[model samples]
Target: MRYVKWTFYTLIALTVFAFLHYVLPQHDIVRITNTDTRRIDFGENSIFWASPDAGTGAAQATRDVKFIETIQQNGRPMVYRNEDTGWIWPPYFKFNSYNLQTEASDLRSTSADPRWVVVTHYGWRNEFFTIFPNAVAVRLAEGPNERIIPWTNIVILTLLAVAGIMLRRMWRQFRERTLDPLFGTAEEVWEDAGDRAGAARRGARTSWGRFKAWLRSLGS
Candidate 1:
């Protein structure tokens, strides 16, 4: 049982970590190699993709998805799909897919004279299942070795910590205001009952002693 409880807690922690890692924004500095658009079919791998364009009821299983081709500073190639996440989960509020496509196209560079860019995006690029991260914003970087501080991550974690503290304080307040009073009343009632029982027992003992004394006098 103890092992099972620890295993359950570990799974829950891992799930939360995965969820935050997926939903949070991350920055990648890379050189734009090329750009393309192709039709993608979101079948069993649908959960890996974001929601349809904003204000649309439902999205079809297949659609034309934009691609931003780039190469990282480490000489590894990376591809990101430019898609409108709409006003949904993760809440980037991004609706400028066409503009972003134009920007990425303009920033395209070759291997010889690489034009570095900071791709502010959220999601994951998986090669096996064919999933690409969604780009939210792009900016010109000084060079391939530009350092970007993760303010987004810091702010998000701080907000989560504040929320957790507030929730714990609220729970404690509710117990003090609501449940504590009832428990206090129950304790008082139990103490009073104990006192009454003690008095009744003493009175019975005194009456029995008098009865014994009277029987002894009668025998004499």
Candidate 2:
């Protein structure tokens, strides 16, 4: 049971971490390589992609997904698929796929001029899974060596911490108000039962002593 409890806690922690990593916004300082739209046929990996265009059916397997191509500070190629999250899961509420694609196109620069742009995005760029980070916003960055502080992450973690604390307080209050009183009543019942048992034993002892005295008197 102890091992099972620990395994359960570990799995919960890992799941929370994965969820935050996927939902939280992250920054990538890179140079825009190009921007294009491709008709992507999402299959089993459809979950990685965002929702289909707003007010449109999500049944189609093939759609024209806009993409923002970039080269990172380390010279490694990174591709971001620009899509509107709409009013769906992850709740980005982003409906500016066309605008972002245009912005990415405008920000494109060669390796020599190197117009570094900060891509604010969420999700993961996994080659094996064929998933790209969904770019949320973009702006021109100073240089490849620019330092970007993750204020979004800080605020999100702080809010999560507050929520956890609030939940813990609620649990403690519930235990004190409900479980503690019930347990105390049970404890009192057990103590009262024990006292009754001890009194009965004493009563039986006194009766036995009286019988012994009567037998002694008859013998005398």
Q: Largest lDDT belongs to which candidate?
A: 2
Candidate 2's displacement at residue 180, Å, is 2.1
- lDDT (10s digit) by residue, model 2, range 1-220: 9999999999999999999999999999999999999999888899999988676676578988999999988889999999899988899999888888898999999998889999999999999989999999999998778999999899989999999999999999999999999999999999999999999999999999999999999999
How well is each residue in 68-155 modelled by candidate 1, as lDDT tens digits?
9999989999999888888778788888887999999999998888899999988898999988899989999988778899997999
User: Best by TM-score, which number?
Assistant: 2
TM-score of each: 0.78, 0.83
Q: Per-residue lDDT for 124 in model 2?
A: 97
lDDT of 1 at 10: 100
Please estimate how well model 1 matches the true structure, expressed as its whole-model Cα lDDT: 0.90
Clash number for candidate 1: 0
